[model samples]
Target chain A: MALITCQNAAFAYEGNTAVSNLNFAVHRGDYLCIVGENGSGKSTLIKGLLGLKVPQSGSVWMGDGLQPNKIGYLPQQTAAQKDFPASAYEVILSGRLGTRGILPFYSRVDKKIAEKNIKRLDIGNLRGRCYRELSGGQQQRVLLARALCAAEKMLLLDEPVAGLDPVVTRELYRLIEKINHETNITVIMVSHDIHSAVKYASHILHLQNTQVFFGKTKDYVQSEVGNRFLGITRRQESGGEAGGGEGSD
Target chain B: MIDILLEMFSYTFLVRAVIVGLLVSLCAALLGVSLVLKRYSMIGDGLSHVGFGTLAVATAMNASPLTVSIPVVVMAAFMLLRISENSKIKGDAAIALISTSSLAIGVVVISITTGMNTDVCNYMFGSILAMSKSDVILSIVLAIVVLILFVIFYNKIFAVTFDETFAQATGVKTGLYNMLIAFLTAITIVLGMRMMGALLISSLIIFPALTSMRVCKKFKSVTICSACVSVLCFFSGVVISYLQATPTGASVVIVNIIAFLLFWTANSIIRRGYA
Candidate 1:
């Protein structure tokens, strides 16, 4: 069964329609990459998926018999977030909040799981440090750890590595790969990095405002529709394009 | 001074006022961190103005301020939340609109009711000297409710405050928590009226959080430090008011400013030395 389904979904902010006739299905253990230009309704779709913005028409259905706590998310980071006064540990611990309900305290088991995840990220030493004091990459890692705290089966990352050096970007992708491969968790990440998507994702979703293309990564590379949607000249040699093409780096 | 202190101890109302002030200090510090972090530092200011209007209207109607103000401010809170969610009016602007309008209505209502003869100095500027027994009890109860909510929703609140979209993606119900924060803020504003008053209440909700950020590098430490600063400042303000016969709200705000300046100066010096 599909873990998340958006069927004929439509969303509007006031009178302006942001998304219309959107349809998608996300199964477990699939690494799907959503690629789009800015204001292509990508964030709006994600918001709908997360149940933040209710659809004006159609429905979004998370699979039945699954706990709500199984979903995890990493939002786009802003410069202002650096000055927020939360510790990395505390931020990560918040992931457990969904599963713990609205209770007054964290259980010992919850603490243990959170600690284990923190140590796994190898940022145990920095756990007690303020989230704001850390470098951007470190803060992102801490946020990733926090996302993992509650996310058991699926992870949704929204432009996780939007602004970073090449080395840090690769390292961050590696961490995400490890989580996906080792845990067999379904991963849906939105990125402008076509190269990285080619490297990591099995499935591709290209969105341009009302336009959308969904298929296997290889299929997207070969198909006429995919080529037009992606606005890329396909290379037959590697079934993917050449090095560091526009916005991919 | 000893005689005044003794006199204060003798009155149950005074004792209750002190206790209520202490409790509210903790609440202010706790919520202050997130408010400042969100950069919506004017929430307290906006909401308090709404509370002031509600109080004035209630007084004009010859109704109980506490009872009337709660629903009025709570409704205003919902309106603020709805307007902000529209993505048309910016958050600060929406807050400003509601704040100024309600205050204007309040001023008009008060003028009409009392023919502009009644003294509302205590409500405008804050006077711990005038706190009644019922006011003290109400503040205490409200403070406790705010504290309990914080303890329960600490994680969720932190996530939403830090990055709202991320919290929603994680299945954390960001909208619900957002409404919860606004609701609690309304209650805090109404309860804050007696001690902090309309003019200076925002300072109590903002300064402690900023001071904590200056000295503490960690989130947990910031929260702890903010709470301590709030409690300490409340009593010191009370004492200063006693000694100088100044307004209690102004005294507390002065204390907060001193702490903020001191902490900022010390932080800059330390950073400079290291550099």
Candidate 2:
């Protein structure tokens, strides 16, 4: 069954359309990556998915109850987030907020889920440390753990690895792969890094001006539009490097 | 000193003044951390101006300033929220335009109506000596209500401040919470006007949070430390006012500034030594 579905969605800010005529669906346990260049409305699309921005004229349906907690989302990073004053544990535990009763108290079961997620992310030692003081990679992991703490079925990430070093980016993608494989959580991430998306995504959606390409990764790599936009070449495959997609664009 | 204490205890207004200052300080200090963290410290400054405008209008109309100011500032707060949420207008610019316009209109109204040499300085700088029993009860009740809201919605608040989009995605209704915060801030500013004054209230909102950051390593600790520092500054400022014959609000703000400087300096020294 589809975990999320957006049909004929069009989103605009102040009457100026940012993204339009978008249609997509993600089934349970699917890993879908959305890639687009700057100003291609990737962020805007993500916002619509998270219900932060209402589409001008379309419908977005999530799970049966259509509650936010049923799906977790990670927005693009901000400088304010880097300087935020919460500890890793505190930040992670905030994910359990929606699941709590109206009294706004966290129960023992909630605490256990938070702790278990922290441990699962292997951020156990950083639990007491301030979130701001951590390295960029560590902060991203803490945020991921926070998303995991509450999310039961799907994870939506908006360029989660942006602005990170190469090593950190690779590490995060690996971890995301682990999350997809182990938790069986459907992952839909907005990304600009084509290589990472190609490496990790089971399916890819390339969003360009008022258009999109959606298909399996293998077919996407070989598609005429993907080859043109992503610049993939067969010769570079022998070198076994992402630069294989460098020249065609 | 003992004679002064005896004299102060004898007056019902003095007891009320102390209670009002303590309660307002406690609530403001806690809520202030969130405001400062979110970089909406200016919202306190803006709401205070709205309070001043309401006060002037109410005074001119011969109505109770408290009653008039609450609804007026509450409506102004709602407008501020609506304007900020208008994705077209930038948030800070919206706050600036509303605050400046309201304050300017208030000044013109006061000057035209009360040509009788209005002591606006007292409102701008505060006149704790002028607090009454009813003001104390009002402040105490506001503080209690704010505290209850904080405790009940602490997690949601924490999430919203840290990651607003994520909070909304997790079903927190960030827009509603954002409006609720703005409303609470408006009420808090009005309640605190007697203690911190219209001009200096934002100082109380920012300093305690900054000082708490120096000594605390966690969000909860930062909140607790800020509240403690605020209460200590309140009592100390009252005492110092008696000693120096100065205004209570200015004295309290001064004490808070001093504490902030001392704590910041100590933190810098420790960091340098460790490095």
- What are the lDDT figures for the candidates, one per model? 0.78, 0.80
Which lDDT value does model 1 have at B253? 90
Report the lDDT tens digits of candidate 1 across residue range A195-242: 788678988877776547776889877877666644553342145643
Model 1 lDDT per residue over B1-275, tens place: 78878865786755776787778778878888887887767777888898888888888888877889888888887777777666777888889988899879888888888855434666677767656677777878888899989878887778778877666655667788878887887787777776678888888789899998898987778888999998998888877877787877898899989999999999999989989
Residue by residue across B150-265, what tens digits does model 2's lDDT show? 88888777887888877877777888878878778778778878567788877777888889888687999998999999989987888788678898889999999999999999
**Residue A16 lDDT, candidate 2, scale 0-100:** 81
Top model number, lDDT:
2
What shift in Å separates residue B185 of candidate 1 from its native position after superposition?
Answer: 2.5
Best by TM-score: 2
User: lDDT of model 1 at residue A245?
Assistant: 33
Off by over 4 Å in 1: A1-28, A52-69, A78-80, A210-212, A228-249, B1-13
| For model 1 chain B, the run of ten residues with the poorest summed lDDT | B115-124
TM-score of chain A of each: 0.87, 0.88
